[model samples]
Target chain A: MTSLAGLIDRLEDAVAHRTPLEKEHVQAVFFLFPLMFFIVGFILMPVLGTLYDAFMRDVIFLEKEFIFFTNFRYLFSDPGFWNAVRFTLLFVLISVPLELAIGLMIALVMNETIPMRGLLRACVLIPWAIPAAVSGRVFELIYNYSYGAANWLLRVLHITTEPVNWLGSEIGAFIAVVAADAWKTTPFAAIILLAGLSAISEDLYNQARIDRAGFMTRFFKITLPLLKPVLVVTLLFRTIQALRVFDVIYVLTGGGPGGATEAVSNFAYKYFTAGDFGYGSAASVLLFVIALLLSLFYVKASRFGEA
Target chain B: MRGPDLHTIRRRVSGRLLILLCLPMLFACGRGDAETDLVFAVGGAPSELAAWEKVVRKFEADSGISVRLLRQPANSQQQLQGLMVAMKSKQQNPDVFLMDVAWVGLFSAAGWLVPLDNLDRTPFFGELLNRTDVYDGRLMAAPVYLDGGILYYRTDLLEKAGMTRPPETWRELAESAKKVQEQMRPENPGFFGFVWQGAQYEGLVVNFLEFAGASGGIQLQDETGGVRVALKANLKALRFMRDLIWEYEISPPSTYTEMQEEEVRTFFQSGNAMYERNWPYAWTLHQSDGSPVKGKVGIAPLPAPEGEKGVSTLGGYHIGVSKYSDRKADAKKFAAYVTSKEAQRMVVLELGWNPGRGDLYEDEALLERYPHFGEFKDIFRKARPRPVIPYYIQVSNVLQTYISGALARNRSPESALEHAQIEIDSLEQRYGRNPEGGGGQLSESFPYPSFTHGEAVP
Candidate 1:
């Protein structure tokens, strides 16, 4: 009892003689409480709920029973899930490198001494500024088989005798969707690369020039090596985004032409919309794990942020 | 100025903090007004909503109840998803739901809709009211409008081709469409023979159902008292659909990518296709002054195979009071009002929606305005409902996928049907035979209660 009283006395003394740092900490906690509450309540809770739902049999009006790993077993055996994974990987493989190369070229051009460089940079970002859904609709129009600009251009150039059904076949739909996605997101990569380029010291380039290095040589050795961290970061973001590609594909083809363009996210969304929440949640959890592994691989492979 | 004491500062800060916390609560409490606001959730084109808004105003004035119209996603699948989410969460804001005909069984089976046993359904078409309105031995929804797949053709082109009547068989229609296309190709280079909703969506399922029904294709059969897929007729129908695109070249290759009703309507309205299979609403659009086919359009029942009668897939919207609604009485009142004969007449005349009431089809003014209400009534009477099972969404998903694959030439019709049958069987086993507890009766027979018709639209 005496020790308890002594502890209480110590606590009261500390409170009465609180330091400025302690007062500041209390104030910071008060300010951050709402934000912390929002993050935990909205984001964290839903994620945990999804994980919980993944291990249960959840259908509408049916009793939800805890059936551990059954949903995962169904997913593993489901051809649609595997098809979605294949297409998602194919999309990432095709779109990310094209985005990186085209983005790097644009960033290099924007970094050079040129007239109206700011305007040019702004114009390059127009595609990215447009919402993905709106851009998707625009691309849908552009790829229309009967009256699209693409076919008109092809006809005017005398390239083909007939208009191509850009979204009517599997490979055609896949290519068209990939092009649309790359068109909308390449500018984002370019902007990031441009930022990285700006951060590199101009003196380093001058020093390379003094060493009689050619443009190609300097590009390979200096720009790429120095831009590694930014490139890794940009690739990680784009890779994750590409794996879960949905909006453009949903609007453009709706994973049609025999589900040729369905991404993992689209597949999960289908199950979710169909009210098979358990299977959908399982697919989502698998997607989360894949994304985590991919991000880890990228970080490790690039030795990101290392000297 | 005198310096404030520490206690006073603490009290002031605490008071401000309390108000900040209570502000949201205060606003929430402020929403409790005397006037009851009933929310009706609906989906469709903005123009369709505009037509319904007039009806809503009349109802509001008569009942002295304010209504907030909540517009849902235009896509039917997305709309269904949104409603399912809201109902799953038991939201009470949407007192009334404007549901597609197919959703009546699913929603009612899930116990999301209130049973409107007292609503007088005698005025509605017997088939629609009996087949789609009832669920688990209860009248769950009231039909607001009736729709079915109809064939729209170019009258001028058919006349030019020396044909006075629309073709009645798929073979005949194909020949006529090809003749018209070849005849018109010299003048209109963009012309095609026929167009329909071939996209891999619900519309595709509706189109397939029409063809399948006409060809005597039963999706499910009672074989030895066990439900099984009847594959032969479905395979034949699928082959015929595929031939429309690849073999006959009647439909454009782009049909594989078209996803909505509007796409087919646009092709037909632009005078690019000789014939279009679509819902009844397309007739009004095609007859409007802005359409290229205005005054040149004709409506008829869809062509069937040789040994069968023409069949149209049943479709329309029904109004139901949400089980979660706080104002069920008001919601039921609104539902009853919108489906009343007077409102039905106005909607039918103005919006080109087929009235649910059988007697309205025979009204002199309505027949004068529409001119083809007789044929429409006949089609609705004989319209075949898509399988009325609670797991219909999943079943339709599987059907559309395989049917689309067959149409796209990604898989043979035989293989596609085989695959689809397997998937559908699994869906049945997983979800149970019938979620509606209807004893897995295949809906081949009219098992629900029937109403006496005032007058048949012969």
Candidate 2:
């Protein structure tokens, strides 16, 4: 016990001899240690564990054996895996642009000097505020074949003689899911872009107007160029999110109509739930690689932070 | 030195604060005393769960053992997934599992379940008890309730169509449904001839099994040495199901999208269809006060193919004790209690569950309360179980995919079954050989005892 007390005294003397600023730096690091430990333990460890599992052959009720690269090789050959990849790309390609365009439009409108601007901005966020699962259910009800509001409006408008099965066909289900996702996420993108819009000086717009610039010209020149950084960030985030879409499609179609809407995440989720951890982990690793590559491309293309 | 300055004091205090902050986590890391409370994972409708709560209360009072109920997801597939995760992790809290009938082979082969070979089986129906509980000459689970697929038709519509009884064959049923549809269309313009679960899910597998059984077809035929996929019977069943939608135009195209039993029930209960193939639960729902077809529905055996006996797919929950359970004795007692005739009677009287025991079906009071209980008992005795193999989930998933593909016109029934057979064969090769004595070998066909139908009650 006396030796332990002497060891503590020596540690204190070593710390006391350092400069006050350095001592403060040491204390700051000590404060962050617990948080760093949490991230490493919970998040990083599980990620590494998944990566390690990807190299094995594991199925429930069977012994796990190390078969490096075999899972990936099998996945590459599986038709279902390729189908999921194709649909995931299609979903991301369609939803991201639609979300960006609508989000920018809403953000521009909210940037205007209008009455009840705060209320309007808050109201625009309501759809985004609803949980994705709940919104998926709402969309499910709205797209019901017999009693949905979509068919009701169409009939009231005399658009068709019969109610359309919005969620029963492949193309119809795809379009319906994408529309639901876009509706749920556009407001979030709008809020982000709105912050960017607020950051731009009002004087710049005034100068553009004085220079005889029209609305479209000023938006193209000033607004677009200034919002590029924020837009790129939003695109990167949404692209990653859209690539991993599961809940809405699951609640909406369950990847049905002959697996037309099966995303990569859904495929991996199915395998994972079926206790094929090795293959599921392999699929997830591939997804992570794709997401990482896309993020790198965005950062390189935008080049926003360099300056 | 300024006699241990403020900087030294601040550093020591900060270090003490950090240690204090971690104290709760340290305490949390300590494992508590050996758990005495038994956890049972169960899934059912809200009303059924409420009735189960009363039964549990009684058991707790009688045994002095505390029980915690872990409600599982309503979807069967999701519930199985949850159980698999828990069992794979070897969780000791959930001492008992309310498993689906199809899960017996999978859970037992995984070594997640405790063998209940010593339990008395005399009170239960011989066939029902044997088919769901036994796996590879050992009992792994006990029957808690019995559910079988039955045909429900609009009694008033059948009467209007000059049919005094339900159809006895598939062709006759289609003709009757068409006649009823033709008569009822003017009054209810959106009327459909027939509706059932045709989606790509576990329900679709059950639906197909009934059809295949009635046609004297089997998907997996367990022979003396190995298992073989019955491709021809499966193809025929798929063709018949597809024809019901496209060739006959009796069922709607929307059948491909229906995911749960509730969807078909909703359509039938709304008075939109003349015939619906569903379980006995729909009978109670149909007779409920809010239903449009209240007291207008009749239950009957599903129509068989010509010259064949009609068979329903056996469906229900089974109770099993988890191998990882700490309180095995208490868990076993609870399992036995739930399957006991007394508790089963309460289940039937209060929750409308068909009792697992055969004698309870003959009880005068139960028959009086649920007039259709006798019919259900007969259906239960005749119902055939799905393939009892450890790889049943994989087999069912393949069938659901291919059968729905055929129904959706994406592939011909021959091609779909061909693909399904290949997939199932691979599964059998991987898991069916019973390596390591996991007891997954399908070495013989299930012994299905035949029982003569009793006289119908007036």
TM-score for each candidate, following the candidate numbering: 0.89, 0.88
Model 1 CA deviation exceeding 4 Å by range: A1-18, A304-307, B1-35, B60-66, B219-230, B434-458
Q: What is the CAPRI rating of model 2's predicted complex?
A: acceptable
Candidate 2 residue lDDT tens string, B1-458: 34456566556645655565666887886765366778888885787778788888888999898887888888877898888878888888689988888888778777888888657888887876776678777778988878899999888889877899988998988888888788887877667888999877789889988888787775355554333444455556677888888887778777887646898999999999888999887888899998999989989999987898888999888999999998888888888888887788887888887877888989999999988988888899878887776667767766776777777776777666655655555455444353443233322321121112322111
Per-residue lDDT for B1-458 in model 1, tens only? 32344454344444444455667888887785433689998876787788778888888888899898889888888888889988998778688978888888788777888888667877777766777888767889987778889999888888876888998999888998888888888888778899999888889989888887788866343433233343566666788999998888888888978746999999989889988999998887888887888999889999998868778898988889999999988888888887888888877766787887788888998898878888899888778777666778777777777778788888888767666665665566556664454333223322222113232111
Q: Write the per-residue lDDT of candidate 2 for residues A142-221, one digit (tens) a residue.
A: 98776778978998999996667676666887898899999999999999999999999999999999999999999999
Stretches of candidate 2 exceeding 4 Å from the true structure:
A1-18, A304-307, B1-22, B31-34, B60-66, B221-230, B422-458
List DockQ, one per candidate, in order: 0.34, 0.32
Worst 10 residues of 1 chain B by lDDT: B449-458
Error of 2 at B392 (Å): 2.4
